[model samples]
Target: MSKTITLLGSTGSIGTQSLDVIRAQGYRVHGLAANSRVEMLAQQVQEFQPDWVAVVDEAAADKMESLLAGMPSPPRLLRGPEGLIELARHPVDAVLNAVVGIAGLGATLAAIESHNDVALANKESLVTGGHLVTEAVRRNGVHLLPVDSEHSAIFQCLQDAHSAKTLTKILLTASGGPFFGMKREQLAGKTRADALKHPNWNMGAKITIDSASLMNKGLELIEAVWLFGLPPEKIQIVVQRQSIIHSMVQFSDNSVLAQLGVPDMRIPIQYALTWPERVPGPAPELDFTTLKQLTFDVADEETFRCLAACKKAIAKGGLAPCAANGANEEAVRLFLEDKIGFLDIGRLVEAVVDSESFGGTYTLPDVYECDRMARSFVLAHI
Candidate 1:
C-alpha cells in the first residue's frame, strides 16, 4: 500500500520537504527531476533510490551521472526539459511538480496525459495553462492536488459536506510580504537583499522576492480561480502577516471557514500527498498557547500594482495570464539580479501585460508563444 511519488525539482524547497514527508510516511520515490544542483540531486538519489532521475542541467547531469557511477544501482539519468517531461510520463502513481517557473507547465501536462495524479506546487503551470491543465484533468480523470499552502487550505476547506452551490466565496490569505504597509515612495529604494527577507515563511530567493512585492499572492489569486473553479470577483485577498491562517471560504449562509497552521510548507505538502487519509508526520503542529493574536487587513493595491494587474489578467483570461506569468518571471529575475528595483518589477510586469493582446482560446502553442513574446517584451523594456 506504499505510494510511489515522482518528485520534479527534487532539490528545491517544496521537493525537499516532500521527500521528508515521503520518508516519514514510508512512501516510495519513483522518479526525481531537477534543474542544475547535481550535488544535491546526487545526494537525494543516494537516499531515495528512485527508478529514474532527470537533470535539466546538461553539465550538471554529466556530473550527477558520474557521481552515481559507484552506486549499487543508480537511476537512469535523463537530461534537459525534455527529460523532465519524460520523467513526468514515467509509470508513477503521483508526481510532485515543484519546478519553479513556466518550465513546469510541460511536465504538468505530461503527468496529466499519462494519468498520473499531480501534487502541484508549480503555480505557473496553472497560471499559464489553467484551461489546458483543468481540461486534461477532467478528460484523463486524474487527481490534481494543490501543493501550495493557499490552494491546499482551500482544498481542505472544501472537504466539508457543503456543496459548491452553498459556497459563496473564497478568502485567499496573504502574508503581505515584507513590504506590507510600505507606500510606493517608501519602497522605491529597497535593495534585492531587503526584498528577499520574508517575515512569515522561508522560501527560495525568487519566490521570496515575489512574496515581497505581493506578486506571489497575485499569482496565487489567478491560481485559486482555476483550482477552485471560482469567479475572480468571488475570490478575496486578505493580508494576514502572520502566515498562520492559510486561507478561508465564506458560504452563502454568511459563515466563514478557514485553515490555520504554522508557516511550514510540510503541512500542505503532506496533506496533498496523503490526501483523504491524513497520515501522521513530524511536521510542526501549530501551538495556540504561545500564539499571539492574528490580524487581517486589505492589501494596498496602489502600492502592490501586481495584485491589481493579476485581477486584470483573470478578467481578460486566455493568454493574458500566461503573458503575466512570463512577464513576471523575467521581471522577478531582473529584480533578483539587481538589474531592476523591486518596484520596477511590478512596473515591468504591468507594462508587458498591458502591451500584450488578449488572444483567442489557448492552445499549448498559444501559451508558450505568448510566454516567449512577453519575456522578449519585458527584457527589451527593462
Candidate 2:
C-alpha cells in the first residue's frame, strides 16, 4: 500500500529533506505547507505535485498560484492559519509537521483529531501541550512518530521493549550547541552569526539559536517525557559532541541500549514515514570505523540556563513548559532581530516562567493562554 503524506513547512530544512526521503521511497505527497518561502514550495510542487498547499503569507500564496499556472491539475492553495489546519486535517496516511514554533499547535491538533499518524519535528507542539497532544492521540488512536533525531533514537531503541515497566530511564543526548562552555558575560555581545553557527547541524535561524542555548535540548526533554510516558526524573540530558549516538534507553536491569547514526535528519524521516517497516534511503552509512570516539558529559546547567529552566518547568507541571516555550520563542525572535543579547534569552524565559500562574491544567485553552501570557511578559520585560 502506498502511504500518503501531508508535509507542513515544506520549504524548511526538515521539510525539504523529508520530501527527498518521500520521493526516494515512492510515498505519495498529498499536501504541502509552509509559512512563507513560496518560491521553494513552488519548486517542491513542480517536483512532487501534491494535491494541496498552504502558505502562511498571502503574498506568497498568490505567487505560488501564479507559479503553478500551467500544471495539468494544480494544487488547491490555502492561506493563513486556518488553511494550514485544513491542509493538516486532509485525509492522509501521515502528516509530517516540520513547521517551527507555537504556530504548529493548531495543525498538530487537526492532524491528531483527524486520526492521521504524525511525524512530529515541531518541538513546541509537544513542549507546549504534551498532555493535550497525548490525550488527542489516545482519543483518535493516532501514532506519533518522532522525526527529531534524539526522540527518533529513543523510538528505535524501544521497538523490542514494549512495556514501560521495563524501562528505567530515557537518556537524551545533546550536541551541546555552539557555546557549550561560554560564560554569560562572554555571550553578552555575541552576534547572530555566532549563534547561527551550529557545530553539528545546519538548521533555520530560530532553531539554530535554540541549539546554541541548549534550549532545543530543553524542549526535547519535555517532549521525550510526553512521547515515552516517562517521569521527568527518568529523562537525562548528556552532551555528546560527536553527534554519532543520538539517544539511549536504559532498562531496569542495568542495561543500556542506544541508537547511533550520522547526524542526518533523512534517516529519522524515512524511519517515521515507513515506521514498523524500515526502508532503505540515500542517507550516508554510519561508518563506525572512522568514527572512533563518542564522548558523553553532564550538561552544564549553570552556563546554559535554558536546560535548568526546562527542568523547573517540567517539575512545576501544568502550563510551566508552555510558558517556558512561549518565552523562549519570543526571546529567540528578539535575539534574531538584534534586540537582545544571547544571555538575555534565557533570562527572559526564566522571568516569564517565574511570573506565570500555573493553573495545573493542560487543556488547549490553558496552554494557549500561558503561551500568550509568556510572550506578553517577555515583550514587556524587553
Task: Output the number of the lDDT-best candidate.
Answer: 1
Compute each candidate's TM-score over C-alphas.
Answer: 0.98, 0.97
Model 1 error, position 107 (Å): 0.5
lDDT of 1 by residue, 1-382 (tens): 5899999999988888989899998999989999999889988998988889999989988888888897899999999989999999986878999999999999999999999999999999999999999999999999999999999999998897655558889999999988889999999999988987889788998899889888888899999999988899999999888889999999888888899989999999999888888877868889999887999999988899888888888888888888888999988888878898888888877887787568678799988999899989888987
Superposed Cα deviation of residue 213, candidate 2 (Å):
0.4
Model 1 alpha-carbon miss at residue 152, Å:
0.6
Per-residue lDDT of candidate 2, residues 1-382 (tens digit): 4899999998899998998898898888999999889878888888998899899888877787787786777899889889999999998999999999989988999999999999999988989998888899999999999999999999998888564469989999999888887788888888899999999898888999999998999999999989998888989998899999999999988789999899999999999989899777979999978987889988988888888899888888888999999999988998889998888898988777677557576678877888888989989998
lDDT of each: 0.90, 0.89
Q: Model 2 Cα RMSD, Å?
A: 1.3
Pairs of residues clashing in candidate 1: none
